[model samples]
Target: MTENMNDQLDASATFSIELTCPIGLENVLENELHELGLTNTRLGEAQVKLTCDLRGIYLACLWSRVATRVMLPLTHFNMDSADDLYQGVKSIEWSDHLSVHSTIAIDCHGTNKEIRNTQFGALKTKDAIADYFVEKSGQRPNVEKQQPDVRIAVRVKREKVTVSLDLSGDSLHKRGYRQQGGMAPLKENLAAGMLLRAGWSKNSQFSQLVDPMCGSGTFLVEAALISLNIAPGLRRQYWGFKGWKQHDHRLWQQLQDFAKNERVSVDDLTVTFQGTDREQKAIAAARENIKRAGLTGIVEVSLSAFQEHDFSWQGSTPLVIVNPPYGERLGDEMALISLYSQLGYWVTENALGGVCALLTSNDQLARQVPIRPEKHTRILNGGLECRFYLFPVVEGSIKRGDRQQAVMSQGAQMFANRLQKNVKKFKKWLAADKVSCYRVYDADMPEYAVAIDMYDDWAHVQEYQAPKSVDEEKARVRLMEIVTAIPSALNIPETNVVVKHRQRQSGKQQYEKVATSQHEMIVQEHGCDFIVNLKDYLDTGLFLDHRPVRKYIQDNANGVRFLNLFCYTASASVHAGQGGARSTLSVDMSNTYVDWARRNIELNEFSDRDHGVVRADCFEWLRKSTNEFDFIFMDPPTFSNSKKMSNVLDIQRDHVELIDLAMARLSDGGQLVFSNNYRRFVLDSELSERYVVKDITAQTLDPDFQRNNRIHQCWVFQKRG
Candidate 1:
């Protein structure tokens, strides 16, 4: 039987109530119910069932920040068919629970094969209740869909229907504070759950919270509310019990008044919250939301990047939380890998005694975080399965079998020693020449047979494909040892090191990709930027051997219209753009390479209209293009057999035809610089009849490649004058 809203009740009387929450947070909700004085509580799947009085139910609805709904059960009965459901619901004391003047609604769940339609079941239950009320009085209570006074809930599971009255309307998760949450914002309740799982509570003496990647300040506002002892439901105006026929309005008002009184009154508090972001719009939205939450100046927010965030706070270790960008559409595991690894590295190096939690839905990317997770909790963020990587901000205690315990073999030791000696020898030279990208070791020891190039702080290791006579097992062991030795010796993490196999190619095999790491980065050469991918292609977009070649073009490209053939990444055209060239054109056979060239130019703040990247074979393009140039930098591949090309290109056999085709488009006094890497390429002697050729191969050799002058060859040509 049910009582009226203002009906007096025994303070000690307890009733059956069920609390529903997110699946993984049942334990948290259980503890919360215990704190609210609910007795004999038991956890069931995504719910907690307890025995509590009307006041207990009111407090559960008013104080619970994690629970979604609070429901009070009326009865449990078997229902085999629709009539059984209707009769079972009608058997309950309808007058005790509803008034003919109050509006009502029924929410049905589950389905029996006999009564498969939920709406149909709900309609029958509604009829049973309305008819009972109409018979008791002259008219029936009206059915209201928007907000009913008495909300009925019937759940069917295993042919047993449990009828309950919902006491929390529109879900208790909505705190009514958010107005401008940014893209993919984390729900307020989920954010609070994350804080609780990360060992946060208002009872703590002193605490601080910082979300460096805060999108809309959900976490910060939740933290502020928690620290202030403010109940989540204190500000809400309506609930499921407000308009009920037997609603305990006085009891609900008492609960609300009690919760309001529990809020921390002191304006100045010890607890603090801060947030930082890279987007100005996100920061603005977060500010507006914070103001809506009445935490305007309490929670500090600024536009700061995680890279520049200060991990050190004034007092004890603060909790650092981050939700890095992730999704399937965001291509390349490399970016997320690098980002997580960087975040982990920063935590290890900076926040020694602090606590950090990272929430992400990616497992492969989670492995990329350098430090191991101490505790992982699975939760839902907007229905996406995500995990909280909880760990202390300290260096891991190295396990014996982990990478930290790797011991070098004799072969690897010798290889590492040689690399160290080479680095030592070129350290001063690289600095003097302003070289941030260079080949540190080019097989100085024949047995190692590997070329190591350093781009800024990262090392790219290329192993020569061994001959058939070499033992495969022995080579494999040696390569593993080398990988272990390189990162350890260079004092960089293993994630920063990329490995590749270098071998002699047949036809166009060298241009293909082995893996799609998409680990692209920008390296500065002569004050200009070029994109390089360490894992995507055999050749990292920029050619370190062409350092001097680009410098030469930049020096002579002033006020000239430039054209680049076989412009792999437009590194040379970027130099031409830097040299005040009015406009430029570049041609390539691969669309991938053309896109790479466009990114390189844009990265250096150059427009793509004047410096356009065209995807076309130079052979076909040189014959068709009417665009004339005052300067031409033509560096063709030694050989190519692309199926997309009209004809195969072999530099040694077809140098004359390619040069003749290039010379036709050049202005009379313009310079034509031709380069190739074919070790035995011989310029045709007959070409001296039409133009004067000057071999600048020796002059264009930068200091880095002087030891192997055969790495490339170059020639400058001009029309006979």
Candidate 2:
């Protein structure tokens, strides 16, 4: 334990302090105290008992945000009844903490009690203190509830009463910036606590911070203040110690001077903090709150929808903290789901080396984002069960070769061993089920879990487990053995086996370039060819998950004019054109990708007269093009707020509008296919009346990615004749 010279105790000074914290957060508080090297600590229900002279109390008050109140514990005694409570209160030496001329007040609450009434307990305790003073000094202190010199509190829990003096006059949550309220304003202390728990620190030069859904700017404001070493309680006008008889004026002045000197100017730090909200009124309120905190110049607030903004951080790794809508209220669930899906799209498109901390109560919405978070912490906000998920953004597209295959190879071995044992049990279970494709047993047992999908003579088996360490070569070999054993266990020959090793990528390095090429033309699985340029990217091939949809296009196309909106590589259009379409037009914003789409059409041997690639915004192109098409494919990014596009695109929320636009260009009896990658997609119920909607997820899922249904629903909507 490191002793603070300033916090040295004097034997002549005798004092007891009571620290109050949130009920369930006592463990967190205790760990903090332990880290601070505070000695002789005792934990009670929502409180910690520590004895220190004046210096310890000051240190605790200055640094501990979790402590609701720092108190001087005057007495602790058994109080079985009202009479006992009154007698116990009278026995305390009140003169030590309160002057005869000062006003006093009593507050009391009971937990497990013989005296169940809190009002009766407060009145009895007040009487005992008042009568004792009157009898001894011939005068009693006035009871001032609003503003008291010495506030005494009695807490009765489980047949025990502990009396203490409140050192903090008001709740510690009043950090003093919020003069007016906005929608869903988070408590100041709770916000600070959340940031601290997330391991954010001033030492790290994280210059950029953004809160896309900044409701009341709680996260942004706190981040700024903490980075600048600003005292959270400096703006407050009162402390509970002001009324105490032994309140040291010299010590208080010294502490204030230290706090002022330690304060760092926000301008001195290269910190960029901004918050945005869709509601103009909320943005205005956040601006006002930022100004009140004396951080107007350091923090910026804007009226912007989350899906319509592109976040660019100029630092090494930016931190984005967002508390999105949780859909607790009716009519908000659908909107929130749409918002979350769009948020995921934005994260995948932009945000490199940046970390995102998304706070959400819905686990389903959290899964809508394609990438899984590295860590998650369960927290409570106003009785709502929420999780703070942390994801680290890599620089480029993720590839199998970019990852350390050694680790994955080892991980695969362990996964294979687990698969072997599960295959034996699954074979027995398969005999009972009449349906061959149905799920046999789906259970995750930490280190090992298996899911087997049987199709005809062939079965696709996937095994999941934690990745292996760098030097675990033996584990890798053992994993291969286990994988080989699975076939034998299932009564299949080793010659009929196909094995794959999958490694988890590190968040920061997941997207590095693996294969180098300026441009490459590759044949698709179905014999059609598509061209991709990988000079500036790691991925030059098709996303295999969309194989089913491409096949759908090829099977249905014949003498039809096909329109592909938001076409990235134009793979679908090439397939449509190869399927004997009269002509195909592909629209995309990226000129680089538009060229690649043109190459794909040429690679597939589709004549120039039958295919055309347009470099323009898809939505705008769709609105202006008068040419009608018999077939249309609209597979826009799940969410995008790019500068090139005026309106943000959210598949779940804007699908109806997008379908309407596509329908305008569809000839009578023309079919429009809409697809998205949001894992937990929900179609708008109103669309059922306009066009036939169907969930083609089961049909679209490829064998390579079997754990979850990655690609969303593919609905075919035909224009009414």
List CA RMSD, all candidates.
Answer: 8.2, 17.8
lDDT of 1 by residue, 154-210 (tens): 888877888888888667878888877777787777787778778778875336787
- Single out the weakest 10-residue window by summed lDDT for candidate 2: 1-10
Q: C-alpha displacement of 225 in model 2, angstroms? A: 1.2
- Best lDDT goes to which candidate? 1
Candidate 2: which stretches are off by over 4 Å? 1-16, 23-51, 394-721
Query: How much is the lDDT of residue 435 in candidate 2?
Result: 24
Q: Model 2 over residues 1-721: C-alpha lDDT tens digits? A: 1111212224456565778775545655665556456666889877788766676676667656567788766667775667887788887767766777888878887755567788888888889888888888988888889768878888887767878788887777677887755667777766766666655656654658888889778888888877887767677787788887677889977877787787786557876887788877788888888989888878887888766765555776777778887866322342243356556556655566777778788875675454557778776677787887877766432221311121134554455455556556556544543223333223333433444433332333334443555334443344343333344334543222222222333322223443232434344446576554323343343555677788789888989999999887889997897788899999988766787788888877887786988888778887787888999998877677666677766677887888888898989888888887776777788888887666666877544344456535677887544
TM-score of each: 0.66, 0.52
TM-score of 2: 0.52
Candidate 1's clash total is 1
